[model samples]
Target chain A: MSDKTSRRTPGPVYVGLDMGSSRSKVVVIDEAGKLLGHAVKKSGTDFSRTAKACLDSALEMAGAEFDDIAGAMSTGYGRSNVGFVTEESKTEIGCLAKGGYHHFPEAITIIDIGGQDNKIIKLDAAGHRLNFKMNRKCAAGTGAFLEEMSARLDVSLEEMNHLARDAREMIKLGSYCTVFSATEVLESIRNGKNVNDIVKGIFYSMIRRVLEMDSLTERVVMTGGVVAHNAYLVEMVDEMIGRPVLLAEYPQLMGAVGAALYARDENQSAGATTAQASSKGE
Target chain B: MAAGKSTTRKKIQATDLMNQVMSDYFYHLNEAATSGKQKVAWCTSVGPAELLRALGFAVHFPENHAAMLGATRMSTELIPEANSAGYSPDICSYLTADIGAWMKNITPLSKAYPGIESVPKPDVLVYNTNQCRDVQDWFSWYSKELGVPAIGISSPKNVVEVTEGHIDDVARQIEALIPTLEAISGNKLDMQRLRETVTLSRECSELWKKVLETATATPAPLTFFDGTIHMGPAVCLRGTQEAIDYYRVLLAELQGRVEAGVAAVDDESLRIYWEGMPVWGRLRQNSDLFAGLRTSVLASTYCSSWIFPSFDADNPIRSMAKAYLELFIVRSDAYKERYIKGMLEKYRIDGIIYHDAKTCPYNSNSRYGLPQRVEADTGIPCLVLSGDLNDLRCVSDEQTKTNIEAFVEQLQERQ
Candidate 1:
């Protein structure tokens, strides 16, 4: 028996924990398969501790305790670092795909630009994964690159997104290497180029680097905290791909939402198995 | 470094035996001069080991030694030594690492194990262009350095079918090599001995094919990582009775393991097939990622390269030429895909992991559009991973883990 059985509550809730590289997120859903509560916290050195804290906060927001959660599932970089997840944990790819499919029931390609890497996932009409591609050992287009660029420009990351909108002329940065691109960003500054234009150029280059990873399908769904925080990046992606990009509901929480969805499935299946066994006994 | 968490996964028994056989193989080669009977011939991985063995030569594959250098984490120190020489960083890593090992006079194997040189010096060198042109250039440089005569065989490139004419062409080269080999070893090439050597070579290939086929079982008893090491005898001593004996022992152990419901990966949840050569320096790191996910990379094209379906001992040179020339690596993309699809079905492979080696253009050249084509045909997901065979700096461990996690997720979604 799981911890859920030991604490047995009649409320029937599902919990999801997404222990990411930068942040950990938790989502709680009720028996009706409706979102009850969610929480996000920074993922420090102790991923498990951060996950537990996020789960506790989510449970509290739902006006419930740990006993109410019938099942739990974990996803993301620190997924294996967690302890209380009921089912075998999923990878971010599966969670993102499920989340993307739940919102848009069509053939979709998800471009999840996370902290350290970018993933291009293709899904069929039935939400089955057709194929996927990830950036090759490079951090050029990731949030980490943007953060490094922000540090170099001496501008806040939140301010950098809005700064791109003020640019009159876009100065395209060339190098894909983060260190080289940082030097190029500095060189543009020395050449009397406007900071706004340079920042816009950085965004354009980041989008271009991701576009080069793999060809996208007709319907593209963008996810992850990078897009959740920066709306301008989504518009840039929309213009570059010449298609209106679909965003997941609570884009940063999509992985957690998907994990919660999987947890609900496990809980329902377990209930069905128990009911069938009791009926057979009758 | 991802936390070096010790896994409870059981080690394959054949791996230990393979390590012993490989260590003994290197020791014998180092002591060849003292033996006074066995001559050493430096050859390519896909070179004709049977012909060399028929002449009583201890065949040494430099590619195998280069992989060992990469696996033992010595490539970083050695690759630069060759880069300082004429060879650029973009050249095939096997060439750079092997040349670099010679220049630096250091090998991780030598440092770890006593009384064993990394690789034995060659009395003669053999070059074959069946796989890539790098072997030709690599062997030519060593031939010049060691003052030994070099024998060359160039197979037809980009041909759909390897014809009798092509076989005859390669066979003529094989016949030409007899005089040079006979001159070095001070022995005549007996036709009966050559036939016997080819027979043993055929048996070894047959057993190797069976060993790889055994991985088709659910929760495979062996992994591609195990195959990479277990493949040493097939490459180094393919024509010898010793290699045949090694496979017999290995096949029995693996068979027993399968019968007992043992797995290479303890919790084999997904079965994947690996394509291209391993990222040797990070083998353990990459393997741990799969083992962590309960994914079993059951088979690979690299380990199965020695499997020749048509090795006829009745016609030695012609059969040998056909086997070497018909390798899937030398074939076109369409042919390669067809072979990959066949393996996918045979192994019940859930996905394909194509390792895109940065330094090896010849191997990874056609890999860009491969995943799309493979997915369209088989409906099986394919993940293209970027890493170098010998260069440790070319790949990122963190990014590789992320890619693997995502790929595993993709597999789970499909299931």
Candidate 2:
């Protein structure tokens, strides 16, 4: 691929980094708000390094280099750790709302299940956030809880989602605590319950938790790494909420996309300021 | 040598005065027993401190001490002792910390005031049920341990209007305490002194209200964290002339900042209201987080709880009854909702952050459906943050930061 910056009008390119708890993602967007490229990787011990790697991979996918980027923004758990974010980074909830609204552009509710937390964001008709609720102090009904249950059942996280989808009967786990639910899974195994049914129960608990976080509106959007890998979870949420759930085009990269949009807005505002200064000098 | 760091946030100058006055107050309490002239009384935050003052007793509030422990992050260290004493972890943190401090023989205040090993033992314990039932039970437990008589005043709950009968019910209870107080302190209740003390308390409350009102200015001159710390005077020294004088100094400083266009949050883009008790250990962190986001938490229900608009100096007992009975935490849900609505409009609040304090059931219970109600009624968004005033275990800084940041973004979107 040839570099198009010199031949073209040198349009601004924005990069967004989402340093999530379990994984980090980065996305590159052009001046027309089109996704150029994106990449995702596990977020290891060093968030800043992982964020840099994710951005590098995304830039490579877009056939571009770091010098081609005009602005950068960051979001998610390690938002402040990103070195390239020139402007203030946004929160995960804000990014989720922005990402969902960018897709739907109407009154919508977003349910985001991440490694250690779950968030429910409500947006108005004009794509403005009205309110949001988050489950932070608990590990139950989050991606981490599902991972723990997978460990308890001696299965991989990916396999648990597949097994849960194939189950004919679903077990209903009563406890909203990860430790207690782990014990309950063991008890279910002792009672000769199917492992698939038990895994489905864990998914139900997660769906119940996200649904109970707040009141859902007409349009519902589901995003995050958990839903990105586990399509059955959105099916369960749709069945429970009694409506079809809209999935983000790049589910795991939604936060990064929202951050990219923010970067583009910042870049335009800066450009406007420079233009005004030059016009005044004239 | 590159030296001084550049800073933009304007720190409150009143903080210095607050520390000085609080230090002197604790130092005076440390010497109260050694001086041998004044008997010490342990009172609740909303209890009858004016009456205690009129009877010539130096008073201290355990709630204030618990708050100090909370702010100093010492409550978690002492909580295990309370747990060892068979108190469940689910109980009020203030109880656990206060009782745990007694069990472990630890006092954070002593570090500030030298030679003060613990809180001055009470000659008599006094509490009121206006805030919560925990105060009564907490005082009773300590009273039993110390082998001292305890007096309590119960206020009527769910009253739409605070009637004369309601005031009389609490007034009688307070009047019954005079004999016990006079007998214990060995000093008669001087009617003139009681009247004077009540007047002073009224003046103090009015000044505190004005100080809180100064946040109404753009880019609020006082943040809620500052209010939480400044509340030490109102809770510990409300009836004292020193408390009156201290607020006068504080109000002056706040007025000066407002005129000079100095802000608690630099370049504040949004103003929000905090509806519950602060996460005491993380007050500065949370305040700075909001400041970093260009959001100013201008006012709160917790700090405004001390504002008594019903004080009648002529009828001291009845007025005290009326004033204490109408505390924000003691009122019904409808009254609280209306009060919150009024505060939202008065302060031009862009959002509300409701702290769902884990151990404080009385203050935390109303937060469940109240946020949705406020959003529907006022067209203002509400974010519920699950945290504890004293227990750091229940609070997640990452979660709270994200929630508050999103709330600010929502406000910006609306703008």
TM-score of chain A of each: 0.92, 0.93
- Which stretches of model 1 miss by more than 4 angstroms? A1-13, A41-69, A84-88, B1-23, B34-37, B84-89, B108-113, B140-151, B175-179, B217-221, B253-270, B281-295, B365-368, B412-415
Q: Which stretches of candidate 2 lie over 4 Å from their true place?
A: A1-12, A84-88, B1-11, B365-368
What clash pairs does model 2 have? none
Candidate 1 per-residue lDDT over residues B1-415, each given as its tens digit: 1222345656766677777787788788878844656898888887877788788888888888888889987886788988998888888998999899998787666765587665677888987888888889888888888898778788777657788888899889888888988999887988888899899889999999888888988779888988887888888878877788889889998898889888888778899989888999887777777887788999898888899866788999888888988887777777777888999999999989888898897677335586678878888888888888999888887667767877776777667
Native contacts, share recovered per candidate: 0.59, 0.72
Give the alpha carbon lDDT tens digit for every residue of B1-415 in model 2.
0011233666677778888899888878778866767899999998999999999888989999998889999998887788788876777889888889988788888887777888888888999988888788788889889998889798777666777888889999999999889999999988888889999999999999999999999868999988998988988888888888989999999999889998888887889899888899998788777777778898999999998877767888888898998898888888889999999999999888888888897887445577778778888887778889888887888787777767777778888
Q: What are the candidates' individual DockQ scores?
A: 0.34, 0.49
The per-model lDDT (C-alpha) reads 0.83, 0.84
Model 2 local distance difference test score: 0.84
| Per-residue alpha-carbon lDDT of candidate 1 for residues A39-130, written as tens digits (9 for 90 to 100) | 88889899988988888877777767887778888888788787765535777777777778888889999998888778888889998887
Candidate 1 colliding pairs, count: 0
Error of 1 at A81 (Å): 3.4
Instruction: Indicate the TM-score of model 2.
Output: 0.94
